[model samples]
Target: MLDLVSRPAPWHQPIWQQLTAQQDFAHAYLFSGQPGGGKRRFASAFAAFLMCDAPEHGFACDQCRSCHLRLAGSHPDLLLLEPEEEGKAIRVDAVRQLVDFISQTAQQGGRKVVVLQPAEAMNVNAANALLKSLEEPSAQTYLLLISDQPSRLLPTVRSRCRVQPLGLPAGTEALAWLTEQGGERSREECALLLQMAGGAPLLALTLAQQDALAQREKVVEGIKALLKGQVAPSRLAEQWNAVPIELLLDWFCAWTLDLLKLQQGAVEHATSADMEKVLGYMAQKLEVQRLLAWQDWLLEHRRLFASKANLNRVLFLEKALVQWKNLLQRR
Candidate 1:
């Protein structure tokens, strides 16, 4: 049981406190935010509040039986549902299991809480299944759905619950919070991560400290190698393929956009401190028209990343990388 750190965004104190304060309210809630933005943390804190016999400052007293049970994941009344596999949709079966559990009534004789992390991962059938439960919720049973991609959810589903949208705080605040956690990171790195995380510091730290950042850095290095004509274009594309398919296309676009800026001498909009060398190398080596054309590739890549676009991702990168190298050589 990963205890809610409640940092990066202290939504727990501001939002969850109010939600928990409601003595009589609807059972359904939707926590929408960037991944690691503390939506799930808020939900867990709220869940602990709901089950705790003694709640202090909207937090559960660990001394209470309810808190102990919740910590053990045996809180009979609280069910935390999430996808077992990464990047996989939550199937109807998981929702069905929740339905079945909810139907059994409260076990600890308190409020029944159902938490769905990344609620948007529910496929149509699963969403429908959960919708049925929401349509006619049982007594004392509450539903908390947390998702970063709320717009992808069915309007009906979105409408049925109260939506809590969380965004990232200022970099200074996030850094303060992270420093308190004993983690050391530079402001420039934090700035790059914050923007890359789409304003979510929790997400920034998670992705930055995780393998994703390392992979993206490597991919950027590969791109640099391609520009220098020191690496095979196909090898870099292979590395991109080896990275997470879902996130690769996104960061790839970002990298290209940076390249686009550099080639045009938009150095002020540079992303990293090391951008000077990369930008100078690119500006000296690539034509203006070529950089502009790569932006078009990036636009298409962005589209594929946002859509059901498939395998062409790697092919797209391979083609564009070759074009980038060609254009650089033509210099």
Candidate 2:
């Protein structure tokens, strides 16, 4: 549903102007930034603009044939490459498909745009496959690779492309975006998502709509169960074992850290009232140093889980809680 109009104000205006001024673009351009900050929308709109037969000042004419096709989600040149379903990484096979597509003549013999998002998600084989395409790109084909973590991409891939990095909009700008979304302007929710999402507006919006009301209620219930000290860590593990470790860890980090902040008389920002309950309980048992140590442990575990490996997440989380719980018991 993202388009030019719906894009964040800063991105919608500036990038369009720059691309408009370009006489001819390099074959490979990289768009890297915090997730949800409008990189994908900019890519799509740029693609739409390039294909528009009658563009308006570097903007797409929604009524044009190409624009219509794009609006219908059927543009031939508007290809999006991504990770394969059920697989954690983008495959070499998918890169091959993109290479083939970009090498061919455009459906209408105009410019073609290929967008590969979260390009950092590509594995070694996939990155290598893409390198060949970039090494000798088609004359009229343009590649836009979007990435949240540019460091994850191969240095070779990074070198071939002109990287454009997006940044967080100022508070005033972000608040304007939230107002457009028709929210009551809760800076707590806004700041939490912004911090976690790494400054991506779209990501913030998506997380904001995560049926958080329900998920938050569940998280509160889970914390309450754990606080009772009667609930076994194994039982708690079982409840959340199947969920992605990153999800559980991230929620835990935000939920607890905010409370520690509030207890210190810092401005109570970002933590929902539901999060306060767990915070209060934790503050009683955990000194600042121990709480921070536990947070670091979870963060390290999160990184390991994201890599090319399998782990017993349940056991890991259980072990982590065991230490924290014992601390509570001792005190």
Using TM-score as the measure, the top candidate is 1
**What would the TM-score be for candidate 1 when compared with the true structure?**
0.81
List runs of model 2 lying over 4 Å from the truth: 1-12, 183-199, 228-245, 255-293, 307-320, 327-331
Query: RMSD to the native, candidate 2?
Result: 4.0
Clashes in predicted model 1: 0
lDDT string, candidate 1, 226-329, tens digits: 87778887777777776765565566556567766776667655564444477656666777776777778667666766555465656766877787677665
Model 2: lDDT equals: 0.72
- Residue 278 in model 1: lDDT: 71
Instruction: Give the per-residue lDDT digits (tens) of candidate 2, residues 202-269.
Output: 77677677644345456557767777776888887887654556657777767556756755767545
Q: Which run of 10 residues does model 1 get worst, by summed lDDT?
A: 2-11
- Evaluate residue 54 in candidate 2 and report its C-alpha lDDT on the 0 to 100 scale: 84
Clashing pairs in 1: none
TM-score between candidate 2 and the true structure:
0.79
Model 2: which residue pairs collide?
Answer: 36-200, 36-201, 36-202, 36-203, 37-200, 188-270
